[model samples]
Target chain A: MVRLLRFLVEPLVLPRWWQDALLLLPRLVCGYLLAFEFGAVKFGLPWSPPDHSLGLFEVAFWFPGDVASYGGLFAVLPGFFAWMGAFSEAVGGLLLALGLGTRVSAFLIICTMLVAIFMQQIQQGMWNTLPAAGFLWAALPGLVLGSGRFGLDYILAKPRRHEHV
Target chain B: MNTSRLSLWLSLGFLLPACVQPAHNKTVVYLLDVRGIPNVQQVGLRGRDNPLSWDQDLPLTPVGNDSSLYRTVVTTRTGYLVTEVKFTVNGEFELQQADNRRIAFGAPGDTVVYRARFNVAGSLKP
Candidate 1:
């Protein structure tokens, strides 16, 4: 069991360079894709070309309805939560990619992923959960490791370290 | 296989923002007692699990011999959440309350593959 757990988290054991590359690279891909490409149609610039259907600053009507249907606190203010979720996927994804407020952004991503898991992914099956799960897994390390040495978090923190010298 | 699956999911991800509905597992509703219904052209399903909302009502196609069973696999994110469904038969008659409407997958990795068999009875048209 311990070995299994290690296998799951073993990616963290890589050398500094490898870890930094892993951290920076995946964050770039996942965050950028989620923000500008994947999530943009739903949450950003409202672009719907002749053949496409996309919107901006608008959570699809069905999203809140689905959240409300999930019941619990989600039923109370589904719109607020829906907006938050969408924003996190869009703006938060950008911040996360940039390593700005690395831990905080990761935390937000974590919350969105939790919803994706229990609220959405759980129902859709594992296949549907992969994107959420991938983000969740990627964000966990970011939350713990501060987005690695290559990230803005490090660049910002670097000056502080030199201040003592 | 993994690569193909991953690409498919990525494509789905791109499409998801425009269609921001809850994730739902595929559910097959074997609507019983649909035989007596007159001119059953199409069957649709809606439910509380869907928060009694969702613009599109899932259509149930006729399956098996004699059209006795209308088959439609619905999708939802929750596994055990009881989906109270009402079936609109022939675009007129309404059949509410169904059994096994809980849409669930066999395991975590198989979200697209649902193992739920919803055998709902028409239970008299109102």
Candidate 2:
């Protein structure tokens, strides 16, 4: 457990500037893609396509209800659980992009991708799993690393608290 | 951070149940949603069933009091089959879930009931 924790927070051996730039690339692209593109369609935002009526705070309930179609404990309160999953993806994705609440947002993304990978994608095929797995890997580091120096998380953090990263 | 971690753990605790969708061996009933459509003419289910192409659609029957819920029952020869519902709600044909919904009719000879839901607020895709 201690070794796992150490690996999670292990500082990069590279110079601070290089480390910041490397992490910044994924942090920006993945965050923007999830927040601006996919989440908008499913959860709704100013830029959400005008065609579908899925509005902010609403979920694509059919997916959760689909989960319930399993016909077991999954059938109970499927809507509520579904809403939580959607919320994590849409809202959490946005936060991840902005690097606000970095740890928390990363945690949410981790859970959502875990389900996407294990529950849905594994059954489909490797191509389907690859994209989610990419985000999953990116978010995994963010879960422990938090947002790096180039993000809002850095500015919001206090002095001498570099350890937070 | 401690509060946030606790909440994350709590959220995981609640979400754990959504992960248990095992394949069941049963003759399953799939209930699709046709609720709250502003105007309607007709509705049906379409997909790999009946015909490989979605050219043909299966009709849905309404349940008591709720005009929105529609249902259908099926037994399986094949393993896992996916499908979508098409509503001729207002002259134009609209499909549910962008046709993303699916069903596992379970293993042959088992019986169970499952529900699927979809809603279109206004206007169908062109």
Candidate 2's error at A31, in angstroms? 1.2
lDDT of 2 by residue, A55-148 (tens): 4565543456555654454576565556666667777777777767667777888887887787677888788998888887777656767666
The clash count of every prediction, one per candidate, is 11, 3
TM-score of each: 0.48, 0.52
Interface RMSD score of candidate 1: 12.3
* Residue range B39-96, candidate 1, lDDT tens digits: 7677666665543333446677767767566655544554232345555664443523
- Error (Å) of candidate 2 at residue B26 is 31
Instruction: Show the lowest summed lDDT stretch of 10 residues, model 2 chain B.
Output: B17-26
What is the Cα-based lDDT of residue A149 in candidate 1?
63
Off by over 4 Å in 2: A1-14, A70-73, A160-165, B1-126
- TM-score per candidate for chain A alone: 0.76, 0.79
Off by over 4 Å in 1: A1-15, A45-58, A160-162, B1-126
Q: Which ten residues in a row have the lowest lDDT in candidate 1 chain B?
A: B111-120
A93-155 in candidate 1: lDDT tens per residue?
887788776677778888998997888777877788887888988777777776566666666
**Model 2: how far residue A56 lies from native, Å:** 2.0
Error of 1 at B28 (Å): 31
